[model samples]
Target: MKKKLLPLALAAAVLAGTMAGCGSSSAASSAAHNTAAPAASSSSSAASSTPSAENVTLNFAIWDSNQEKGLRKIADNFEAANPGIKIKINVTGWSDYWTMLEAGATGGSLPDVFWMHSNEIYRYGSNGMLLDLTDRISKSDKFKLSDYPDQLSKIYNISGKQYAVPKDYDTIGLWYNKTLFDKAGLKYPDETWTWDTLYNAAKKLTKNGVYGILTPLHNQEGFYNFIYQNNGKVISDDKKKSGYDDPATIQAMEYYTKFIREKLSPQIFGDKERAEAMENGLCAMGFFGSWNLSGFAENQYMAKNFDVTVLPQGKTRATIFNGLGNAISANTKHPEEAWRFVEYLSTKEAQEEQAKLGVAISAYNGAADLWVSSNKTFHVKSFIDMVKYAVIRPYSNKTTAWEDRAYETLKPCFTGKQTVKQACQNTAKQMNEALAAE
Candidate 1:
């Protein structure tokens, strides 16, 4: 289940060296647009065991650049506390991140420590690519699996061995154009807004070369929320079957794509286009994740015209929620140093610092409020408020394998090439085939 599309020329760069920081220059440029702001560095009082890697530069790879500033500050405190070990942060886009990881995994030179997600964690953990942290976590007084969200912790555990620690959790939010809403005389979206309310707003706002909303062919930030909101699951809870064919799921899909069918949303296909549409005022609203805060905040247009609120509910209140994990390479030369850096990241100090810096919603218990306070530019508390009914982003052992396959089958529905029901039914068939093989 590995994506081996990484160019061979870049494989050498993935090794610890001058070029170890970034894999795809183009992806980096797009991702770096939204990033960190200056914040006070907060140090930990916790102690570390003597490290063998006195001058080792631990390459820490992550996808979102929005977090780089905050994380770098945290790393500075860590280095100040422990003089010898150095942490080099590598920022890459989401797609390139996996390719770089796959290249490193296959070539036995993966980043000493990197980010892991529910979609790909199973492949890495099951393949013996990640260091087992269960014992270390049990031995440490500074870190504990119980300190984080239980669902997030379980995502990185396979067969009772913990491969990673929860870094942060994110839920989708409704990002809307405040300027456009004011012009249209429409009230801002709130917790009371339902699917019907969203559609009505989109219709009212769609006029004079402007879309009321943009829901692309994306899943996590698109129709997936609607499916769960309507009581339709993606993968079954037991991880054995597809729920795409559920009547409720198909109904929700129909409603989600209606904006496009009615020409209220442009047929935006790529991830970058989604953000651009909102930034350029081509669309009045879109669903984005909490991870986008740093980037979105830095964008002047978004800062002036946009504010995020909880996603509009359907049959019930729900949002597609998921968290990232920090994992060490099973093949890393400096295992002790890698664990030390990862341990620091998992500590309460680091997690709260992450929230205070608006990196992401820290998965640590009680850290969400600080994250809410970190950003005053918008009603970010809405991100934390939705936690009550947040659905852990759907997953299974072969999540990545089935997700793209299902997307290929259902993308046509967004373009009006197929009916939503037909697209969903076809997706179910392909998803079940992939799941059965697993």
Candidate 2:
């Protein structure tokens, strides 16, 4: 077994600090659990497995291919204890994952158990596309909602019915290429660094064929951290209005897009390509969520050349905090098998295994230390450290309706075709319209 990176107490302290409020955060694809806890000694769950459920195949779906290996290993452990079940994992890219899941929901063929994200949960959970696990969760001795953060659990709860269980949480971290910094004779980034420091360094690093940083036209892993750092809000407190036009939000976004205006960042917008830019030496720095840990650690180039640190402070320090949840399909024919698999995933033992395998920072309290230890090549502790001042990724009912459109609405600003102020104003208008309709 891999040893934990940090002390148990330290990890618990971080895990204990929950998302704090209702704002936001948390996946799709792949097919693929046993006893939920005490992994080494799986004596089976509270009751005997239903004989009719034997030889069952539970389809598990997730978006990030990076997590598939670690999750599959966990699934194998589950299968060992429960000989009757088999898991199949289906992998899809982030953009396509939601599309596939939505279609599955409409067609009544959703995966037996799948990952649920905060941005899209309201639509799924409210419409009865997801299994209502409230009663099952209450009865299961193997799983307890108290083991996870309350704010995260609230994301999957609609009208007080818990539809899912929190899986893992993430905070944005700054990834820098140490070799590039060395070449430019600049100091590495740290907690003390600020927005001005980043901009100045980005300028100095922009030389030869490599851009200094990657300012992707994305949200959660991109400008959302900046927006929150500058004390900007994405939506109002009541979830009935948009804050895109707020002065602070506009200024933060203006500063973010300024990177492209001054030629300090590449015009890259896609998610996968952001990491590619780093591995290929096209950019010296970028911001990405902790969930990317598995993929980043797997790349030999990133493993050797890069390190991670907390996001630079703006008006005050902040990072985007979010998490994913494991949910069952309401239409699943094998409800017992699906619940059992999700239950296994939620247990302390399985969650720790997930952390040890570098899959994600497990939502199970105190398991983060194992996750930090799973990858030794980079300073990933920054991910946990930022949780202190983390801002929940913004979300509300019908979040996707407006959030997805905000990207297209703001695309022109990244390319210097529109003023940041005008783009943000337009985005706020659109968002308000969507929220009002909701």
Worst 10 residues of 1 by lDDT: 16-25
TM-score of each: 0.91, 0.89
- Pairs that collide in candidate 1 are 34-295
- What C-alpha lDDT values do all the predictions have? 0.79, 0.79
Tens-digit per-residue lDDT, 1-438, candidate 2: 011222322112111121211111222223332223224244534223554345988888876655777788788777767668778877654556778898998899999998888888899999999999999999987879999988789989999999989999988889899999999999999989999999999999999998999998878777888998898999988999899999999999999999999899989765335545766788999876687666556555666788999999999898888888999999999998888889989988889989999888998989999999988888999999987788778899888899889988999999888999999999999999999899
Instruction: Give the best candidate by TM-score.
Output: 1
* RMSD to the hidden true structure, all candidates: 6.5, 6.6
Worst 10 contiguous positions by lDDT, candidate 2? 15-24
